[model samples]
Target: MNPTIELLNSHRSIRKYKSQPLPPGALESFIKAGQAASSSNHVQACSVIRVQDPSKRAQLAHLAGDQAYIEQAAEFLVFCADMKRNTEAAASTGIEPTLGMTEQLIVATVDVALFAQNVAIAAESEALGIVYIGGIRNNPSAISELLNLPEQVYPVFGMCIGYPDHQPEVKPRLPLEAVLMQDSYQEHEQAEQVAYYDQQMSEYYQARTGGNKTSNWSQSMAPMFGGKLRPHMRDFLIAQGFTMK
Candidate 1:
């Protein structure tokens, strides 16, 4: 495999970061790399807010489920899916813009995700560690308010970037066969594949935690499936002008 693929495959989320800051101009370069990602119809619907103020970072830390890393990391970035710019741009063309379609939400969300991943890859290449903070969705409305996000814009996620303070084991993913199907959708072997992956994950957790953690992939996913999912997102998204039609 090439160097880029090798770098990608070695990715691990770094929660503990060193006190050192990024080299001058590096953050801009990373954002530039992110901008180079493919945008849907060149809409460039993604926007990132670099949180530099300590007070704001502290507020975000509390809002994002008390994730102290947001305050500790050298840089914290909130990635947002934004159609406000595009909608206004379109309206400027002498036509009233219609917004709040479900597809529009998906497009902007996917655009932000793709853009953030590009930034992640770039940061990793430069020997920086990054951990994505999805907990921002815990209080999306509060986050939007803090960030001053307008209608047609919503916070999808946040990311922490800095020099790694410690190394962590790379977590395993689902088997190729389970995720990659042929032409049509197939799940004939999904259960078996997941079972095997569960065992592998169980061992990984056991070894990583020195027998403190003893849960498989399926077992760990229980909370997500067992009514622990964030249900407030639907109303929050709608309130944020992503009405999903």
Candidate 2:
């Protein structure tokens, strides 16, 4: 197997870490790699906050569902979808940006993910391991305040980077057929595809928990979508100045 392919394929969340620190200049290289990601119209609506203070890291970990890993990371970064820089630029010159001005929220989200993934790949290439912290969204306001984020900017996610303490199994993903569609959208096969995916996900989750847990994809998605998370997200986005019409 190709070494590059192997690195991409073997990706998994690494929570635990060693005390070993990253080499000097490694982080700059990683940030450069992340900035190299493709952006729509070159907006590059991404910004990152590197958490260096121990107290701040601990507080962030507490805010982010008490995920201990966030504090343990040698480098913890909070990625944000930011339009402030662009807006500031436009306002300073007395001009407004073109269409989708309100949609910078979405663009920034993609930018954050692109940069985060790029950093992950670079970190892996350097024998380091990392974990993305989606739990940071659990309390958006708290995160924004903790990082002192300005308006028109929102925390998309957090990431933990450090030397690995353990190697976990790579999580399985949905089959390609479930995600890929034909030339024209076919509604008929969707249910079957979802059902197959549900079964695969159920088995995958169960295996991860040593057969102590069982949950189908449909069952798992409800809490994540229909539950409090969705309404809270809508509220959070609105408060963050993203008026989703």
Candidate 3:
């Protein structure tokens, strides 16, 4: 495999990080790479907030389920799906811009995700480790207020980036056959593929946790699917002007 493919495959979420700060210009370079990511119709509806305040980081850490790495990481950033910029830009040109269309929401959300992933790949290339903190969505309102975000902008997720203090084993993923299909959707093949994947994941969990975690992939996903996971998100997004039409 090429060096880029090797780097991509070796990715691991590094929770523990060193105290060392990033090299000068590194963060900017990574963000530049993120800006280069493709956007829907070139709208580029994304904005990233770099949280540098110690107290704010502490509060964010608490708000995001007390993920200490938010405070500990060398850099913590909140990636936001921002439609306000685009809407205002359009209004300046004398057009009455629409506020909250479902398609607009989708475009902004997908744009930010693509932008952040580009930043991740760039950071990884520089030997920095990163872990995405979706916990920010736990209290998106509080975080939004904390960050002084305006209407038509919402925090999609946060990311912690820093030099790794420890290396971890790369977690296994579902087999290629399960996800990559030819011609069309392969619904009939899923049960067998998932069953095989479940066993593989069960073994991976067992070894990773020294038998303490015996659950498989399907079992582990129970909490997310079984409950109304982050049910407030819909209301919060609506309040942020993304009414989903």
Candidate 4:
């Protein structure tokens, strides 16, 4: 495989990080690389907030399920889906641009995700460790207020970047046969595929945790699907001016 493919496959979430700061201008370079990612209609409806203040970081850490890595990482950033800039730019012209469309929300959210992934890849390429913190959505409103975000903007997620203090084994992924389909959406053999994959995952978890974690992929997903996960997200997005009309 090519070097890029190798790097992509070897990606791991780094929880513990060293105290060393990033090389000068590294963060800027990563952000710039993120900007290079494709956007819907080139809207580039995404923004990043670097949380440098210790007090704010501590509060954010608590809000995001007490993930201390948010405060401990050399750099922490909140990636936001921002349509405010586009709205203002459009208002500058003669037409009254529409707002609160579902498509608009989707575009902005997708843009933010793509941009953040690019930032992650760039950071990883530089031998830096990073972890995406989706827990920021746990209290999106509080985080938005803390970041001074305005309407037409919402926090999508946060990312932590720093030198690695520990190396974790790269997690295994679903088999190609289970995920990659033919010309159409085929599922005739899904049960068999999933069963096989589950066994593989069970073995992986067992080895990784020294038999402490015996749960497989299907079993581990119980909590996520058992109930309405993050039910507040709908109302929060609407309040942020993403009315999903």
Candidate 5:
């Protein structure tokens, strides 16, 4: 297998982090790696806010669903899906802030996530650990205020980075047959595939959490499908200068 593929297979979220600070130049190199990601027409519609102040980090942690790891990590980075620069560029010439269509939101998000993942992978190559904190959107309004984000810019997510305090087994993903689609899409075998994946995941969870089982896909998929997350997201986006029409 390829080296990148081997590294990808070992990917896992690290929640607990050691107190050690990153070595000199580590953060800079990570930023450089992020910039190397391909952008949409080189727009590079992403910006990172690195939080090192303990009090600020704590406030961000509270905003991110009270995840203590956000404050505990050696570094906290908030990646933003930004069109603020474009808004400026338009004013500089004769263009206008494009009221991004709902579908185009995916482009902004994918651009940001790709850069974030590049940084994560680069850091991991040097033995650093990271956890993507999607919960940052739990209180996006408050987070935006705290981060002093402008209109046309929104926090895509946060990341906690540092030396890992512990090593855990890789979480089980669905079998190749389940997700690796062929020429023609088929759903007939999904039931059996899910059952097998569920068992593998259940065992993996039990072992990771000291024999206490949390949930299986069937049990949690319902609430997730019901949109239990920030349901006012459309309204929120409008407030942030994104027209989802």
Candidate 6:
């Protein structure tokens, strides 16, 4: 594999970070690199907030399921899917702009994901460790209020970047055959493949955690399917001006 592919394949989430801060301008450089990612119709409907204040970081950590890494990481960022700026820019042309189309929500969310992935890859190439925090959505309204996010803008996720204190083994992924379909969708042996993958994951967890974790992939996914996860999100998004049409 080439250098980029090798880097991408070896990516691992780093939760334990060192006390050292990032080099000066490192965060800015990564964000600039992220901006190079493709945007929908050049809408660029994404914004990132760097959380440097200790108090704010602590609050964010609490909001994000008490993920202490938010406070411990050298740099913490909240990536927001923002349509406010673009809508305002369009409305400045003496015409009313649409506020909350479902497609608009999809575009903004995809834009932010693409932009943040670029930043993640850039930071990894620079030897910085990074972890994405989706728990920010556990209490979206609180997080938005804490960051003072405006309508037509919502926090999609958060990211923590810093030097790694512990090197973790890369987690395994499903086989390509299980995920990559051909010209048309088919699931001939998907169940068998998933079962095998589950076995692999079960062993992986045991090895990675020194026999502390014994759950397989299916078991790990139980909580997500067990109940209505984050039921407040729909109402929260609607209140934030993303009515999903």
TM-score of each: 0.98, 0.89, 0.99, 0.98, 0.94, 0.98
What lDDT is reached at residue 205 by model 1? 97
Tens digits of per-residue lDDT, candidate 2, 95-122, equal 7654234466677788878888998999
For each candidate, the alpha-carbon lDDT, in order, equals 0.94, 0.85, 0.96, 0.95, 0.87, 0.95
Off by over 4 Å in 3: none
Model 1: residue 241 alpha-carbon error in angstroms: 1.2
Model 4's C-alpha root-mean-square deviation from the true structure amounts to 0.8
Candidate 3 local lDDT, 1-245, one digit each (tens): 89999999999998999999999999999999999999999999999999999999999999999999999999999999999999999999999998899999999999999999999999999999999999999999999999999999999999999999998899988889999999999999999998999999898888888999989989989999998999999999999999988
| Candidate 5 lDDT over residue span 128-214, tens digit each | 899999988888898899889998899989999999998988887888998888897769989999998888877777787898877
Highest lDDT model number: 3
Q: Scored by Cα lDDT, where does model 3 land?
A: 0.96
Native-referenced Cα lDDT, model 6? 0.95
Q: Give candidate 5's TM-score.
A: 0.94
Model 6, range 1-245, lDDT digits (tens) per residue?
79999999989999999999999999999999989999999999899999999999999999999999999999999999999999999999999997899999999999999999999999999998999999999999999999999999999999999999999999999988888898977678798888999999999999998999989998988999999999999999999999998
Give the Å shift of residue 67 in candidate 5: 0.9
Model 2, residue 178: displacement in angstroms?
1.1
* Clashing pairs for predicted structure model 5, backbone only: none
All models, RMSD in angstroms: 0.8, 2.3, 0.7, 0.8, 1.5, 0.8
Local error of candidate 4 at 166, Å? 0.9
The positional error of residue 195 in candidate 2, measured at the CA in angstroms, is 2.9
Candidate 5 ranges beyond 4 A from true positions: none
